[model samples]
Target: MSPRPDTAARQQPSPSSPPSDRVRRFTRAERWVHRTTAALMGVCVATAACLYLPEFAELVGRRDLVVRLHEWAGLLLPLPLLAGLASRALRADLGRLNRFGPHDGTWLREALRGRRGPAGKFNAGQKIYASWLAGATLVMLGTGLVMWFTHLTPLMWRTSATFVHDWLALTLGVVLAGHIGMALRDPESRTGLRTGTVDRAWAEREHELWRP
Candidate 1:
């Protein structure tokens, strides 16, 4: 049977025209939660630097003010995420972050080779980071609280908490730097995060498993 020209033409996209389909990647609530968490995280990092580095301490001047800011920022680190739990979609996404799938293993291997494979809304690397950060945030908060309430914690525990908090802060700073570096290099990811939407072709290519 001979196919009609019109039928064949409609079956495939035109080569000359760019795909116009766009998909929503992040909801308004999701964007707001991410931005709020980011701002608080930045405050925690900056104040920690001010307290730990002599140069930053001199620049910041008021040690008391910096200490208070650091304590509050670290304490509130999980608040945005907690608030986001109201959204069913956000809660579902959190579950996805906590689980590892077969495709995620393949994605990790491809990622090492500087290639991308099919992934859901969040890839293996992102899931790993999110999972780690969730636990790390709790650890930091617990240690920070122990240090803050010295009256409640024994001298030995306080000393141990202080050491843990200091070292964890440094580790988090390095991981965050790498996260920011990757974000800066990936324009489509950046655009999707900012605009809450991504080009259909890009989404289909990079996140074929993602469904919205």
Candidate 2:
């Protein structure tokens, strides 16, 4: 016997699957800013190598072009972050980077003891990296400008800027190497950067305090 229309409709099995258990980790604009910043930094590093290292200089050739590229890339390094301010997500994350909680201190101690601790969106290490890099980049920009525009500063000031710029570039290279190594070791972090989302389970596990 056929049931009434309302009864049949109620008895029909659900068709769609459950929603995905993923949380947004990075917004599209945030990812774009990161990618653009990395690319410009890479250009600066590569061109710096060409200008400073004899082997790379010989291999690449065209001294004038390399210098121009390096200078322009360095000059444009901050544009991506400035443009990304249009994104609310990016603005919120920047605030997270600036704040250090009591939990961050606990997280660091537990990390030293080979244990995991609850962490918010930006952990202690990440916060330190972000803050340090921001200051370093500004210093680099200031020193680089002085070096480029010879008439902008006195001879003594230019010499000091050159000294600081060279050493800072080398230090930045080492820090970047460590950062890349750590990122490569964590596939989940790479996935977050790539897809702008992370598994809810992974977030709850790794960032117990940050499950959204």
Candidate 3:
């Protein structure tokens, strides 16, 4: 028979452990960059919708006003994104998001089944959205420049730019809504993004695979 459990083992208290504290994840500069980009994107989307939707445009009229707002927003959009890209930590995080690994495939499978799997720092869906946003932003910037500086492109090219710009804006707006919804689904996640630090339990539960 197995040895009887020791009364001393049960009676003696376990070794004292230090209390866990939440650590700062994103630096102030990094959080600033994220906030700046999000704000600019929000304004750009709102104004673009006003310009595109006939009912909405009628209320906000003057195509020139919407066009000017979009141009300025386009100019400001790259600043924060570029700053984030320059940071070593942010760049590394972006690289991790770009990578498609076996774990990502497993996560995707579980996601399709309406089940949650162990997610790393960013899951496959988030990675795809990030990539799409980065690409779409670049495309929008280039196209916007062509439209803003009409002298740079022929009339046909300008017309094409209009089509491309409008469609991409609508698509990105939809994608951004989904991304924001996912982030807001978990209160901890929204708090983390807003405050740049999350509870240790939240980190371990949602991003255990993220090793710094």
Candidate 4:
């Protein structure tokens, strides 16, 4: 007599089945917004460098063109994020970024010791970075607008705005460089952003609280 058919089916894995090792991490819309924001921010940062660095300014020439490009790029920096709010998942995730659980503090403590604890989709460090970037972008936008409309403002105010804008841009550039460096060093994290899926084992090890 043949072994039970149901038992046989349960024993054999399907050859054409999708890989079970991968789990969806980011939605397509999330990835789209992330890429768009990064591209726009990159343009803003590059133009800023060209405008500020004497060597780059001389090499690039067309100071006025670079200034205009930088201003426009800065103004557009928040658009991708605003558009992403249309996605329910993105909206929900934004809320998640705002809330800090006991586990988050634990994660930070572990981080200080060169270790990490089980964290949710966004770790404590990432949440802090996202929050900081959101505020920084708004501040940049406000100062940028004031500088762009310098003719409408008092000369002193315009000068102040320019000072604030320049310093903020420099700080943001440094922070963004660190962000890029960390992303480059973590292939699994990078893969999640690019492919919207992370290896199940990788996710479990890095973000134990996250469930597929």
Candidate 5:
């Protein structure tokens, strides 16, 4: 025999080992909820824009039809968000997001200067956005329902609800535009949100404190 079967040469150790210390930031279900909400929000916003824009109104004529579509979209908007909130893990993450400390302030200061800061799991801005979106969505849903069911409210209340609903929609649209721009600004972040996984380097660089 050329060599004994049990006498093969041993291999040397490799420079790098497999990652065994990383933590799971988002579960599969949580990711699914996030993605679904994002998709629905995109469609709703686009449809609302088409209905609102004077030039595009001809394509989606009939005020009743536009109102019905908007109402349905608004009704569906909170499902994913509420589902995600049902997970205990996600609720804990929300708690972490709400916590504001010295680090968060420092991160905001640096962010304002056009530099990346040491953001933990989430920066101050992200936390604020999450909170704002939560409140805005609730407001939108309540006001939207009042507008949709005009028979349940007095004429003046319905008019006020209509004003609140429209203004909140406009505000949320602008905020979402900023959110999308920020997501696009960082390829790794965008990838993470899309795939629910990110490279170790990305986590370390952007959220060092988050890695276990």
Candidate 6:
């Protein structure tokens, strides 16, 4: 017999999602965590441009303020996620992000062929993206710290950190733009992120492995 789908963890009913046809895709806590992280990242990127790009820097004369904001935002980037550890729903979803099962492989193959396939609460690509994002966040944080406190790090490491931090910031901006574009293009995903629930039919069609 085939293994069953992971059971849905229900929460307080959302007014935006009708009871008969909606499925809980993200909990309120999960959405808040995502929102907080996005906001912090945006600030970091915006201030980074102000500090690093000459043209952008010309538009803003407050170098100290920009540096302070960027540094603090980078430092606090992980707070929401850490605080979210108190959320059972977020913990469960994080576990899902950590694993790749058979359906994920099949889904990835079909995706490469330009067709959709069965996916769980998170798809294979999403799993990979999440992993990459987590790793990148940590690396950026470490590099940012080294760059910030120049006295502690060796000159060579400081130079290396600056190089990594700059290039990684550029790469993250591109990746985040793609992520935002994809989210905006998918109404169901946008709605789910905003309201913490999605149409059951949409979930059934797109995330079949997540359904019972």
Instruction: Single out the weakest 10-residue window by summed lDDT for candidate 4.
Output: 10-19
TM-score of each: 0.88, 0.90, 0.83, 0.90, 0.83, 0.90
Name model 1 segments beyond 4 Å from true. Answer: 1-20
Model 6 C-alpha lDDT per residue in residues 137-204, reported as the tens digit of each score: 99999999999999998999999999999999999999989898988888998999998888899899
lDDT by residue for model 3 (62-179), tens: 8887878877988899898687776887877767878888888888898899986667888888888878888999999989888889997899999999899988988898888888
lDDT tens digits, residue span 1-212, model 1: 97899998898876644446877787777887899999999999999999999999998799999999999998888899889989887878788888889999999999999898768988999999998888889999999999999999899999999899999999999999999999998899988778788898888888889886
Q: Write the per-residue lDDT of candidate 2 for residues 86-151, one digit (tens) a residue.
A: 999999999989999999999899989989876999788899999999999999999999999998
* Of 2 and 3, the candidate ranking higher by lDDT: 2
Residue-level lDDT tens digits of model 4 in 1-212: 88899999987867644268888888989999999999999999999989889999989999989988898888888999899999998998898899899999999999999997869988999999999999999999998889888778898888898899899999999999999999998999999899888899988999999776
TM for candidate 3 is: 0.83
lDDT of 2: 0.91
Q: Which ten residues in a row have the lowest lDDT in candidate 5?
A: 9-18
Lowest summed-lDDT stretch of 10 residues in model 1? Answer: 13-22
lDDT of residue 170 for candidate 2: 95
The lDDT for every candidate, in the order shown, is 0.89, 0.91, 0.80, 0.90, 0.78, 0.91
Give the Å shift of residue 109 in candidate 1: 1.2
Over 1-212, each residue of candidate 5 has an lDDT whose tens digit, in order, gives 56655454334333343244333456666788888888777777877787778877777678677767777877898888677887887788878888988888888999899888878888789999999998998898898788778888999989998899888889999999999898888887766666556667778888867844
Range of the 10 consecutive residues with the lowest summed lDDT in candidate 6: 2-11
Clashing pairs in 4: none
Model 4, which residues run further than 4 Å from truth? 1-18
Model 5 stretches with alpha carbons more than 4 Å out: 1-23
